[model samples]
Target: MWADMAADTRIRRTGLLERYHATRNFLGLDSCVAASAKYSTEDRRPLTKDILFPALRQVIKTHPPLCVGLANESSSTAAFTRLHTIDLSRIVQFRDNDSLRDALESQLAEGFDTDADLPLWRIQVLGDNTVIFAIYHIIGDGLSTIAFHASLLRALRDVPAGDASPLVQTPNTILLSPPIEDVTSVRPSLSTIFDEVYRLFAPKYLSSDRKAWSGNPVPMGVNGSLRTNVRLMSFPAHEVTAFCTMCQTHRTTVTAAFYVLTVATLSRMLAGDPRYDAISSTVAISLRGAAGIPKDAICDYVSAHRTYPPADPRFSWPAAAHHAAKLRTQKSKARENIGMLRFLLGQYVPFFRSHLGRKRASGFVLSNLGRFDASAVEGTWNIVNTVFAQCDVVVGAAFKMNVVCDPTGALNIALTWGEHSIESDFVESFLSRFQDAFRGLLV
Candidate 1:
């Protein structure tokens, strides 16, 4: 089946080259998502390079478009001809949960010290029951990672005995031509959008440089990192549906409500001003609408848009639905600016591109992955849980929050912080306040 799949594969060039270049030089930030599971039964198993490698190879063959690389002007459609895997044979056990966490943290800090090779993903089997999977951010976002994992797990479980053919392979033929005219002059650059957003929405107290800059430094003290203390709290799946229903009734979206709640919470906590209105946040919007991009080209095709709430204390809950409506409008106008700024930055000040995790702009980040279907792949293997982390941004300010809602209504919130700056207590307080805000909205 593998041979059959490979025989039928064809690759094509895409226009992602420029975008990839811009992202590489500017963001300096890589996004990765990981999921792991532990099995109840322990069985001594030898490393089956054949099984693992062939399976992955089949995936690559089926999804040949993922193999494209960033070239000068055009992307090269080719298979990842050079790829390697590592075998960590040494098995280490932790006596306590703290030990397990410490070991994992140490490994992540050391393992991913540099930018990842694009389109390449890794899988590690610590023992018979434990496994770890990680992927490069450039190729996939948090939602995409979940989708990839679900598909891969399904293939592993259901593929026929000798079937070697790759799964559904798509071609990478999409190309986005940069506009001939300079759009930056007419539209707001990402930085401008962020500045406007901060000015319009962030709390007045937080507006003070001192209040916004009050966190510790990197590498943090003995208390681990701020990210370590961030906990996830989820409401029943019905709650999300109810929230969406409320949004619909108000002519808004669940996403908009989330933003409002987040802004309200931050305004109250960081600035001690509940009446504070407006807060800036970065939202990942898909760019597959570009003319020539292939529908199936597996890549990071999303761009960030800075969103802000209305500067009105009365803009709470249903009233804030108007803000969501406005977001749709502003986002459309910001598209040209988004592309132009990215292009200009890629051409000139390339190094100052990272937007999220950098120390300079660690203000706040929110990624809403709407809803995903995971029923087909769930429980086939024990999936302990999943976590998402953003690359550290360098310049302005950096803080990240990721929200993923699965089909079952399970909502997972992953928050990442700069070790030197944000306090774990602050993060916990934010989460608690967010829940309160949600409840208040519902009422």
Candidate 2:
């Protein structure tokens, strides 16, 4: 029931995710988010729109990124999906857990294109309790989706059932506009831009361990399809507690621990490769607070930390964690706000696209939302575990890892990459070794 947002008609500017996707898409890449949540018979709550759709729709109504209206044929983005109700109990029969996968598979197999629906969102209820919500990366991110789902659960409890209320409101705060201090698309005095120009024009003097598969791709063209698969590796409750305790003891955060873990794994992988002497990476940082973006807004305000570890022989595990803490602190305390500034400038110029290269992987990417507030969806409809994942990543980046620690202290990490770049078997093997490296550091 909100008034239409005021603005220019032709300027349908995309946000962080869409801009990132557009660059990647121009480079021939696409992405999506398939987040799954499980519940049981105890969750007597309703799964229909009447119970949760209003709040979800309210999020889209306010946030333009989450919408799919006619922006001319050039802007072919749909917002909602068809209301297809298929009873998995009767349609596709199966024996065990594969049944769940089968149900999800059949639904997606229905497919969609630019002419599908208004909002590119859908809900699938398997049997009874299990619910799978799929959204294109254009409309959501790992954190925003978490907030959206968490908000939906809260709305469910807040609005009584069978309440045919015409208005469904999302209580979460929203940021209607950017800050006044934003540069508004000016390059300012960024020497780093010149540094990149120097590097690009420089001779290929530094060897980048080509066999490491972390360089500018040779452009496999349309043949370069990015196939992604999510594997959930969880830490035991006790190990989870111990890991957090160790991070605290080391005066670092679990996010830093994850950074150290990924860096340590990279180091281990490149131990014998003399060409590779160092690595730099980025971790997604939320701008809801830093950039004043609202909590409920379905837009991308994530910044990056260009994490570069020191060349010390003894830096491992706990030591590496503290180093990560130091690097992170530098990123935050820096005189120049890289992400926030770029986001402000992004209003006029798309700079994130300039960053699409193998060089971006000098540190790879890492994201850690930590543990979600399970109490937000507690009691009958408690959210236990999450099958959160993303697809269509930039190739030659090695891999993209997202970390989430559920309420029970169970840490879940998902590593995704394009199969065209790295063999699936290699990822599994590397992940196996990464898990081993983590176990070695467990105190």
Candidate 3:
């Protein structure tokens, strides 16, 4: 629906995290993070492409990162370049899938050419009420996906009339937001640097925490698999409310409780394995709050923290409390793995290569984008469901558990894992046990 407008300008060099994600894409390890929103009009108004096309144009205009592409993709000095133009026909599409899961999986399997002349993001429309916004990991993180929907929701309700511009004319001097490093110090303390260096270079036998169990070892062959298996499970609004109340009664948050639940479940499932004495996991923490970035900003301001919890057969409140406290402290610092990335600056590609045959770093990675109140604005439209999903990476966790709450307080959980990384039977048993154990808490 939109034609190409022309202008090319280098915005800035990729940050450490940006470069790492760019390299991951270049290596075909990860594809994209996406947010899907299902909306309905309060006044029973029909949402047409005429309304959506203009709304998307406004969204693209406001979010500067949406107008960028990566340059020098093969080099350490790769930078984000403002695209010469973005053709809406190429970036946006309509799908007739009957199920949201099918549409989401389809988008997840697709990848972006970061070095191309277009922005590293696209939108897929499902039926009339749903839109999936997908972007390369280098440009935005999970929370950034939610931010896009929030902005788009506002745009959809406020689309100006008689706006028939065939092209989004981005100004030549558009200034992208400064990367996280420019806003905060990512350099580690000398002791932190030393510990990381020792941890990375030291042999496993020399380490004191060798008992921590990550899942099966990562594949090392040139043909290491990148195909992903995904499962979706959700709890209705009432159940979600009940769950939250239970969490409050236990003096823990839902995220912390899930962490403990995951660790406890793995402990039971893998108890027969003599090699595992502890369960290690990673939590993705959004740094936007700590970095003073707004929720609506479309950028990557996040970090991850690794936790090693004892593999215990029992799920207890004390463990959840401890984990919750740990997360609070981590969020306050907001520099968990960012410093490590800075230390590995130019070696991201080699760093990922070095982990080919190693045991996966963690059993699972948990990322919660928290809740979005789609009805926050009493506009003509309301967002009913919001889903956040990620494509599993080759060198990372064995599986991923992603959480996001829709407008009606329903929790949408997406379970994803790389194909062949672990036995399907193991994951199936884990899910069964997890659901059984989680229900036990609410009762």
Candidate 4:
């Protein structure tokens, strides 16, 4: 009898572990959205505590998993066994946008200061029904934000919880087996790697080097500094797809093409000695289902791969495409050895976090979220637009160009920069250059 009881307990524990693993894998790859709104006095007339709070409460109840994080070795799964209450607060009013900006700046300055052991979320009301919600990137990605927005709309429309489709699940399988070998292969040597990383990421260029420009420069009379500008741009769905097809012909992904093009354009724009060589960009590769790994167990199996573009001014599209294909192949091999690399790094140089501030080894980031169901929920609530909030990067070296695609075939591209680094016009020019490159490829 004693033996039987012990066996049963062990079995239950194992099952729980599996579930937790699945939840973590799902949550980690997710990005976050810090959404805020401003409301006028007239609009406040219909706002009621009962109506707004209850609706929010309802949304929370239905999406309770959003408040949970990965607890253990399990990567992408959500287990209800461990849950945390996210503090949702309501502030009455702010004197002006400066006040609002200050409050947000303070929050970001803390840098994930909330409970690390538990999943956390927060909601702050600026005034009336005007609220801002800061979701940790651990729970959702840009694509997931769209899903959350859709879920909110459905909940507002009184859609039955049972009727909603389940969030897409990416399989998670532990690929880091024979862990020691995997660790050794990818581990960057402490001395050499850090030097390389530093040289690549540290900021050397000044804002004055390029013509200064701003799109919404802290609108005149605004007391505070502009935290950052969030802009939205969409490519014609069909046109982007057509361009992707061209990339497919070269056996390269659209993301690879984007990275190559970005490097080329930036090199041209910067136009100088250091800019001539290959620019290193980081690529976030999804480890879902790779090497027969189960999706439920994979959480943050993402490894950043660097791609170097040809320095020659005469580099052609086909030549660039060929190089990208080769780089992708090399990176794929490197990923297979991720386990060994991680273990070795942890053992030899545990504190070595890649410094994105180094410009020599790091150029920019290109992230492809693959496809999401964009049109999944519509006519339920008015979605003015969808955009992604940038992730935190090193101050000097953190300029980013991110691209995400939705199931409805929309491609959203965003350029995020360091607060003090580049002006908004640089971003606009980069976008224009991206479009021109895409057109060039198409032609």
Candidate 5:
């Protein structure tokens, strides 16, 4: 129909944040949102392209953002153009491996060429039942990956089994929801402006008694291969429950507790290193719920809150509680980051380029996309486990820690860093100390 054709070829201007990601993409810092979905079947049959392609087709047809690719990526006037058709064979790949870990690290190193006619997303079907959905940050955020898997699982359970004759379909007529700026108001108050200004130019010594512990300086422009180091740790359902109960007992959240744990663990691990006295952490806050965006909708609805947790040698529940209060206060005035972005106007590209070879502002970034309820879907396929991760080699943190919980209350944590950003031995030691401290606290 004429309607479908209009939708297929339409182009929409990218919002401020969306354009900011586009600028990052242009610089080859290529960040992606990747998550895993493991399915179960009573019959124990191997999942094939025949079954998955149909469900994926359904997902593509339903999620309009999936049907788009970036246009004029290197320019300030960049936009998203709806592709007429995406070759399923090129976007959806299959591998006979069961290790989602290997798949995740491999996928992160591969960036999307939005200049091409294909959509800015892909899916990797690993072994029999694990599906890893990866999308460019310009189109979606971390929680967007959760919404994607949830949608795909439902489609898998509902789409009638049959031949995968038609792997691709013409773009549908549905339009993606308006960008976050259009839906919500973000006028920065005078106080917010003053606070941001102070944070930008304040003396480093005034805020801390010691040098900030941001790991390594950012590499100069897409330094070499994009390979990264990754580590995944999971807590069983019982342990997850205990961890939540422990946090509640301490009057803090799991996110705040983990932040304190990371800060304290670093302090103890690098006790005598004279180059650093404080650690800066950036926490990603999802604004979907606050912005009235649906869970299944794909959009970049995220803001950030930065905090410097107490580096007390004796890590206690009280430290975590104090950090939690700070977190609550920062989140209460969310979207200041977006408001700050507005000041950049058309300079996002140059602004990102300027960060190359500079000391990273934060040591690490933490993102927690809380529990995903698989119980809501009463269908044949069950989501057993999930993975969420990202890496930005150009201007990102020295390392990143991403957290998510599956429907069964199992906790999954991914620690990722650009290769060479930090010493391998130091990261390994930090992870070890982190795990040990986490376990010790739950006891």
Candidate 6:
């Protein structure tokens, strides 16, 4: 009984990642989501304990996402305990590019850690001196993980080095949640249920014949067979600024712009079939800031938000912006972000829903972390180019596009798709064409 109370200190109560994690366990899929940040330090020295420990201790003390355990996993529900004493030596480190790639690939391929208590996040050092901090999606969302590293870097720059004291690991400090209405009791309306009907049944997608990131026909990356490839693209600081300016001009978020581009790219790859019109995409949103969660809190509040496709395939930045603006409004009005996970209580889930010929609502996910303040990581450990991405997609989402920019304005984009989607070359080709199209609009 005492153990359970101790565990509560580590277990997060409001997170939705564990629901998906438990579901993945039931369905036998790799449920892990790897959120990583790549950075270049000014000094090419090897990362040492002094360089990394401050952030490590901070993560241990405050971040609940890295502490692996689902709150609802009871004895009647596949019970598991919280990971205690995650050794920094074991949890964080530096590695070469090949080793780093192998480590990340292995992390993505595994369904779950054998040591259930093993922490989900890790740090690595590339041969070229880039620092990549990765966290399992179960604990933190796109925003939390990014925010964690930002704080870590800030600690390095702001916290006086020698003055840093060892943080006592007292995990029981729970934040008192503010008074908020019970959104769940409102119940989804009949129209909302019907909307789910269409969402569950008539979900839009690029045709199967479409080329994969490798350019060959996308492999049959079905259940237990969804192989995924990772690819990267970056826009110079100036270009990113221009894109931001364009977004400002159009009054749309960067994500909406990319969402439109994702739909348009898929359309072109599928040969402009009218069926490609209004292809669906998922936007990953962070609920912490809006929900009043502190920036320093280690909580996962990411929600898979189904978004409306671009109304017009034509390339007008303003038109795309308008569509994006509407999506932003729709996301807020629907309140689906906070309430959608309630469906997990259903007797049958997405995988089962597919047998009815209504494939579970799997679509591409576009997670835009927006921009990071790179200045903190710059003075001593300067940052050059960086990349952000999600390597694991065991969930229903078929493809993931992670976009973020640094303080320098360099836009870093990473894409990972199920082998069934298209070959890697196809992804490259698709991006080239999309860039050309977007360039035309910019000009």
Question: Please, what is the whole-model Cα lDDT of each candidate in the order they appear?
Answer: 0.46, 0.51, 0.80, 0.44, 0.80, 0.55
Better of 1 and 4 by TM-score: 1
Give a tens-digit lDDT track for model 6, residues 348-399.
3463334322232445778887787666433465455555666444434566
Reference-based lDDT, residue 182, model 3: 81
lDDT value for model 5: 0.80
- Per-residue lDDT tens digits of candidate 1, residues 1-443? 22433332322222233244334332333223443323221233322433334444445545432343322221223122221221222111222232323333333332221224333454555544334455444445455555555555445555433433333223434222232122222354567668656854688666523234323333312222322223445666777778878888888777677766666667666564443344545555545443234333455555565654433323265655775776576545544544445434434333333222332333566667666554534334323344444434223234567676754566666565545556667877887877877767667
Candidate 1 local Cα displacement, residue 130, angstroms:
8.0
lDDT of 5 by residue, 1-443 (tens): 22433554656778877887787766778658798878877676567878877888888888888888777787765777777777888888889988888889988888888756888998898886888888999889998999999988888889976757534665656477777778777667889898777766788766542377778888776756377677889889898899899889989999888888888888897688777767878888877766898877888888888766545555778877987887777664676677778888788877887887877878888899889887844437878888899877557877889999988788999888887578778888888888888888877
lDDT of 3: 0.80
**What is the Å distance of residue 223 in model 2 from its true position?**
4.4
Give the number of the best model, judged by TM-score. Answer: 5
Candidate 3, residues 147-262, lDDT tens digits: the string is 89988888887886455444676656667777787887776777767777787779988753588887778788535476767777888888889989888988898999988889
Quote the lDDT for 121 in model 3.
93
TM-score, per-candidate, Cα-based: 0.64, 0.72, 0.92, 0.57, 0.93, 0.78
TM-score leaderboard ranking: 5, 3, 6, 2, 1, 4
Error of 5 at 251 (Å): 2.3
TM-score of 4: 0.57
Question: Which run of 10 residues does model 1 get worst, by summed lDDT?
Answer: 83-92
lDDT of 2 by residue, 248-315 (tens): 87778777777766666667766766756566566766655544556666654555555456323233
- Residue 385's lDDT within candidate 5 is 87
Would you give me the overall lDDT of model 6?
0.55
Q: What CA RMSD would candidate 2 show?
A: 6.7
